[model samples]
Target: MAIKTWELDSNFKNEIAAMPGGEGIMKCFQCSTCTVGCPITELEPSYNPRKIIQMSLLGMKKEVLESEEIWLCAVCQTCSERCPQDVRISDLMGAIRRIAEKEAEEGKIELKGVRAIFEKAFMHQLEKFGRMYEIGLSMEYYKKAHGGFFAGMMAMQKDYQKLGMRFFKKGKMGPKSMFPDKIKRTGEVKKIFEKVGE
Candidate 1:
């Protein structure tokens, strides 16, 4: 985390401020309100919103963009509600994630965790079906996460078996859930995704 002069990009903060949802980046005044209010920070001290913002402002572009911490945000907006500066910290995190995603897409960096994988799976379901298909999403996520369907099932078997039984008993999951019908006019969903450059 050492601040090497050569590693800094002086315009990095401005770059973030110019992005949608990141317009308030310049408003953070090191108040630490976002960190204090972040529920994720409470359970995982390493996921520090304040530190990420500080790093972003300091022009630590590589560190911030490559961080696994940015993807950990739950997007609950507690920090935004509590910010004295109206920084919209939750949205700021989203902005950062967008940038990270762009970087990964362009091959500037490799994303390092299941969060991104899960998001892709979730979004694929929405784009393809115009709504969530829980069984399909789970299968896709597991397949991508573990490299294959059988491998993923084996990895999650014990815990998922118990959970699956509970869900079945409660009528939350069953064979009927496996064959979810796609929403009418699913093309609209793809159009929406395309509009957002997804």
Candidate 2:
């Protein structure tokens, strides 16, 4: 990688520390323990937890905030568990993700489209039904993925039709399963979701 001078914001660390679970970044040393424990790094050699923290501490704001490395983390907490410094690596990653979201909204960085769309769609499913509705969730996901209801339905027809037939034959999952009886206290669940406010 070619070196570029960082337009470092000295306050960047403090800004991240202000977010939930980010304070642990300050406790991280360049020990590489986090990196060693990260399963993602084994597959994605570039997804190094130690490098991420070092870059963040150096205030490489644009690169760190915009990196796919942050999003690549599986949040399994192995890094945190293996850390000698008690740096909660997974939580720190979450903080970085939150910062990425805010930066995207403020137009400081480009957002990852599919990741954001599916996150919203999944959360919408949670808010809409008290429990997960797989078919509804899949439809919502496809809707967001394809950009509309009709288009999404048409797209699913090629494959979901086959899957639907299999589900029906097996009496496993299909239309009836998808549209199961909603919880009578769905209203209460809605209230809880509203209180959480996403």
Q: Which portions of model 1 miss their true places by more than 4 Å?
A: none
**C-alpha lDDT of candidate 1 relative to the true structure:** 0.86
lDDT tens readout by residue for model 2, 1-198: 554655777678888888888987788779999887778999999899899888888788788888778888888999989999988989998888888888888988976546666677777767777777777777888887788998988887875899888888998975668683467678887898779665
List the candidates' TM-scores in order.
0.93, 0.82
Query: Per-residue lDDT for 7-78 in model 1, tens only?
Result: 898888898888889999898998998898788989999999989999999899888889889989999989
lDDT of model 2 at residue 29? 70
lDDT of 1 at 20: 88
Instruction: Point to the candidate with the largest TM-score.
Output: 1
Residue 1, model 1, lDDT = 44
Q: At residue 52, give the lDDT of candidate 2.
A: 87
